[model samples]
Target: MSKTVRIPRRSRAGILAAIILGICLLLLLTVGVLTVGAADAHPPRLVDNAGLLSQAEADSLRATLDQYSEELNFDIVVVTTNTLDGKTPRDYADDYFDYNGYGYGANRDGALFLRYINGSSKEVWLSTSGEGIKAIRDADIESIFDDMEDDIRANRYGAAFQIFAQDVRDEVLDYRSYDTIWIFVGLAVGLGVGLIATNAMRSSLKSVRQQRYAGSYIKGNSVNITEARDIFLYRTVSRVAKPKESSGGGSSTHTSSSGRSHGGGGRSM
Candidate 1:
């Protein structure tokens, strides 16, 4: 003989509610872990080591860099340090980018804008890797420095960084615009226009009138399709990525002190 033990309705309901609550809690925990991992995936774009800019300025600059980096597929970083800590400006910039986990792709494509503000040794340096190196040339970097060195020397850090960001964006865009597809497209369009114009001039000597509809000049009785149906065979959608422009060995580069290859230029402000 065995006793029949049964759970009450209220007890069963409480157990079910507890189980549902437990599942929900587990789901929330899982989502939280994923969120943290995603947030940790990327390093910050703007690191004001020397605290040159105010909080608002840093925030604004960081937002701009973030937007451009995503749009261009290359990280744009800016760092300001009081001193190089005994490293050359180039080495400091390169190592900072390499060690801090910046860059976008396998070659760690990124550009670093460094401002060293040590007394009597104020300097500006640009370090580029991968696509950034291909897009920004030494001469272009020098031109950027020339345009903003005065502001940097004047301790207008905010203004200088803004100018740097704008100039770099322009340079990268200009370089990427030189893809071969653009040239071929331009030539094709020009030839097509010329042919169309010549043909139109020749046709002007003949008689032709623009017809609005296919049935306008047709006899209705000649067409005798009694039934019509459209059958859908398939649907196809195609996508073509923009072609990446070749560097063509334009930019000069060298191995940084960190043993990573980089292209850039620097000058004392």
Candidate 2:
């Protein structure tokens, strides 16, 4: 004959608690690993190689960039370099954005503001990627440069860059709004066409006639109604003006040295 041994209630509770704790720890570890992997995917946003900004200024600008980038889901980067390593300003700016993992999504949606300093002369380039190509038009790029020109010429690099970041954010937002409006217009047009087609089809059925009462289509006692009334909730009114014609075009794109397409423009300062 054999005797069965039983575990104490306290011991059993302790074992169950330990197992739960282990599972929680494992989940936390997995989450931590994923977070680190995601962070590692994107490179630094501000690279002051020429050391144009003081530490305090760099920190403040970085915070601004990070805030806008997160809100817009687009990367906005700034780089200051003493040399382009023998490459043209355009090529250098494009390569740096592409190779350094500066973009946000798979198509790498982002924009880079490069300020290249060579002795007494300075050159600035704006490189855009992915949706950025659509958002930052040629006119918008010129406007950005125009806004920054005075500060840049006065050796206020920090102020100029701040303007660059803010202008890029505004342009992206405006483009998105414009695109959304077109989408809604398309949807409205489609709905109207569908309604017209459906009405035409219904009109072809001569046997069907308009019902004078709602109960005509319902089975007796199937639905009960004590009282009913139609209520007007709201109304919408829209007015649009004729769009003015302009000579300027949208963003112009070119293939970068890395075989990736980029939209950008550069100016000597």
Model 2 misplaced stretches (Cα beyond 4 Å)? 1-27, 30-34, 187-248
lDDT of each: 0.87, 0.91
Roughly what TM-score does model 1 have, to 2 decimal places?
0.68
Q: Pick the candidate with the highest TM-score.
A: 2
Model 2 Cα lDDT, one tens digit per residue, 58-86: 99899889989989999999999999999
* lDDT value, residue 254 of candidate 2: 89
- Give the per-residue lDDT digits (tens) of candidate 1, residues 1-269: 99999999999999999999999999999999999999768888898988999988898899988888888888889999997878999989998998888888798888999988866778889999988887888778888898897888787888888888888888778877876668989999999999999999988867766689977888878988889999999999999999864444467787876678898889888
Instruction: Superpose all Cα atoms of candidate 2 onto the true structure and report the RMSD in Å to 1 decimal.
Output: 14.4
